[model samples]
Target: MIQLDQVTVRFRIPHERIPTFQEYAIRWLQRRGVRYSNFNALNNLSFSVDQGETVGVIGPNGAGKSTLLKVIAQVIRPTQGRVRLRGRVAPLLELGAGFDYEMTGRENVFLNGAVLGFSRRDMARRLDRIVDFSGIGDFIDAPVRTYSSGMVARLGFAVATDVQPEVLIIDEVLAVGDAHFQQKSAARIRKFRQSGSTILVVSHNPASIKALCNRVLWLERGVIRLVGPVEQVMQQYAPDAPSPFSK
Candidate 1:
């Protein structure tokens, strides 16, 4: 379960861009302070997810969809308000987010597993399954920098979902791989759902959201526009358009 109360995330943006450190140094020497403006990524947002609930978040670009996930995942603390979470959380936010570019794919799995509070022995037992699911083949021994974007995403997903966490958070990383891998990833998520895990997913793909989510939360300009049943929110968010999930 997850709950957020009046959560607000604010960021400071400089009015003028300092292209280089040299320019910033010169401006500092001249005693001219850079002006900054505050932007709220999330504005007093409050919501809750029940255990075993599958929720989808959808919005246009810069609408705080990603920031909401980061806040729930504890990657970003809200500037105001409070958040509560229950059980272990497995967050697949950015592709290759916890990986080291210099480390081999095999090594990075254990590294990320450790970050998730797994011991080396625990990861070792799960290593083969993770590698097999990733389908990295012999390339598992190669540096992550040598891998393709799809490979990196696959490896990350494999590690995060191999264990049965109480909560699963997924961002746009599902759009990374080919059709087959997408199917595999979806199946794994369904398995988690069947096991009574809570899920929060963000996707621009209408079909994906329709298929996976029981409820949808619509965010607009750092605020909650609506939150309700999937079809209800979908129709309200796009009234005139044909349903993207319709055959």
Candidate 2:
């Protein structure tokens, strides 16, 4: 199971800067301080998820849904609180930031696999399958700079999930892929759950949440507004518009 207890993220910024260290030290001695806004991204937020469960997270753009997912994925540390992740975690946070643009996609496969905690031999064993699943075979030997945003997302997701993490934390990167790959990715997620991996999905798309998640967590302004069955959460938070199929 995964547990987050009283997780809070605080950030600080300087209201002014001095060109020289001496000037900054003089200002500090004079009690001149910078103004700042403290934004508590996850305010004492806590949750738990059992294995094989799919938990969908929803909220406004800055409501900290992505922040909660990152806390679980260990991509970002909480300023105050604890996150207990019980297994191997794979996080799909950024589409192309993890890949080296100067390197071929094939090299990225190995590089990302290692970054994801896979051994060299393990990455080698999964490279072909990852390439095949990405559906970017023609460009696998090309530098990622040559691939479109969608293609990079596809390839990155494929590599991120190749090792079959015990806990999958998905952010909003799905927005970059095509519908076909979206469905394919959904199938892959189902397969992962079938193998007993827990999934925590963060997306605003209600259909995507309903299609893959069994439970849901809705956050607003860093607090969990709702947490329950997926259908119930959808009923509570669904936008007035429609899913892609509604058109």
Candidate 3:
């Protein structure tokens, strides 16, 4: 269960890059204020996801899809309006987002569990399962920085989904790793869906969205373009594209 009312997340970016802190300090001392431009990552967004509902978010790059997910995930606070969530959330927003590169994969797993509010003992119980699902094998004891990108994604996805959270927020994570792992991740997602967990997924893959979500929310330029049944929105969103959602 989640709700966002008139949520707006605005960011001020410097007009020009100051390569170093020294340059910035010099500019500051000179009383030459840095110029900034405001960009709205999410503009006046209002939406709700009911418990046990699976919603897919579709949009082009820079269309605020990731921003919307981060807002719901509470990783970024909105500059305006309100966000309300009612459940324990497990977010797989970015590949290896919560990992400590210097730590062993085994160590990072416990760290991530703690971040999600689980104790080390709790993680220990789930350790073997997480490692086995990731298929990282012996590499699980190596530093995370030594892992390949695919390895990192596999471990992260395995840890996040194994929690069986009340709310799951995914952002293009299913596209990572190999096809076998992708299928495994999809199966895990389906299990959560059947267990009545609320899920919000952002993906460019129309087929995955259709297979996993009952509704689709299309966003454009930081605003809602359409929010309705998967087929209804998919038809207008990608009418020329070939997919099962097409008539």
Q: Write the per-residue lDDT of candidate 2 for residues 1-247, one digit (tens) a residue.
A: 7988888987665555633688667768889754556888889988899988989889998898877877787878999999997789888777544689899999998888777777889888888899999999788999888998889889888888776789988886655489899888877878999999998888877777888889999999999999999888898798463766876
**Poorly placed runs, candidate 3 (over 4 Å):** 19-32, 242-247
Clash-forming residue pairs, model 1: none
User: Which numbered prediction scores highest in lDDT against the true structure?
Assistant: 1
RMSD, each candidate, Å? 3.1, 2.6, 3.2
Q: 1-247, model 3: which lDDT tens digit per residue?
A: 8999999999998888854788888888999978889999889999999999999999999999998988888888999999999989998886566799999999999988777778889899999999999999999999999999899989988888887999999887777689999888888888999999999999988888888899999999899999999999998888757766677
Quality of model 1 by C-alpha lDDT: 0.90
Candidate 3 overall lDDT versus native:
0.89
lDDT digits (tens) for residues 1-247 of candidate 1: 9999999999999888854788788889999877888999999999999999999999999999999998988889999999999999998886556799999999999998888879999999999999999899999999999999889999988888899999999886666577889889888889999989999999887777888999999999899999999999988876655666787
Write down the TM-score of every candidate. 0.88, 0.89, 0.88
| lDDT value, candidate 2, whole model | 0.83
Candidate 1 vs candidate 2: the lDDT winner is: 1
